[model samples]
Target: MRELTHVDENGVKMVEVGHKGEVFRKAIAKGRIHLRPETIELIRAGKTKKGNVIAAAQIAGILAVKKTPELIPLCHPILLTGVDLTFEFGEDYIEATCEVRAVYKTGVEMEALTGVSVALLTIWDMVKAVEKDESGQYPVTRIENIHVVEKVKAQVQ
Candidate 1:
């Protein structure tokens, strides 16, 4: 069995292995990604022609978070306590951050990541129509910095 690290009586490092699983617990996770320039411009200009870019993306993110289990196999279905999604526009790219909280036996990190990815894809779908010019050129190029920010386990007395 693999050994796991834990703090000892004097706050010293200790190795333990084969710990038993606990029932009914909760966990948290986070993620983010960068957006391309043409994608940003399409969002800013409201030229999607389908609808408001940000609004649609936000809605898609929320929906994705809720339906994460359905989309991804091996992920447990969880009742999310809360989900917050935000977009930060930068000079060269856009930052998408998704935070999800749930009171289940497993963490919601995958859900949060899925939400961000869907949001970005939604943006791409909406803008791809307008991004293609006469020469089939597009400005948006990449997405980066997708990761978790923090995670915590609640203790019961």
Candidate 2:
């Protein structure tokens, strides 16, 4: 197995990227949130009490990508070139895909993953009223399959 990057003789430390050459990097991440069929319909119809669910989630995902360094320790504050969040609806789930692009020394995989997570959570926030059971707890609502779908770094093409 490869060794961890954030470690040195002094123990644990943030990886220094100053010596690394800058490169164009792009990362795509995805996740899904399962909800009641009713909730899905409400979101698709733009009838959720919280307003447009997809719009809100998209905004949340973009903001999360910008704030990733603050949330995850050791992450460099990269200047992102672009951030896009897309959503797909299934019969009972909403799938979020976050694509982040940057020209920096390090990859943006974590930032993309963070964006997906925030977007899915935002959807949960918008639909909780309809997903909660009589016991005031969710019986079937869940967020799953969070993962990095792709990560690429190379010279400008």
lDDT of each: 0.67, 0.94
User: How many angstroms is residue 114 displaced in model 2 relative to the true structure, after the best TM-score fit?
Assistant: 0.3
Number of clashes found in candidate 1:
0
Q: In candidate 1, which residue ranges exceed 4 Å CA deviation?
A: 1-39, 45-47, 133-139
RMSD of each: 8.0, 0.9
Encode model 1's per-residue lDDT on 1-157: one tens digit a residue: 9533444466644233226333333323333334456556767878657889778888998899889878876566777788887887866566677878765566677887888888877776776665565687664444455666666555433
Rate residue 15 of model 1 by lDDT: 34
**What's model 1's TM-score?**
0.70
Alpha-carbon runs more than 4 Å astray in model 2: none
Clashes of each: 0, 0
TM-scores of all models? 0.70, 0.97
| RMSD value for candidate 2 | 0.9
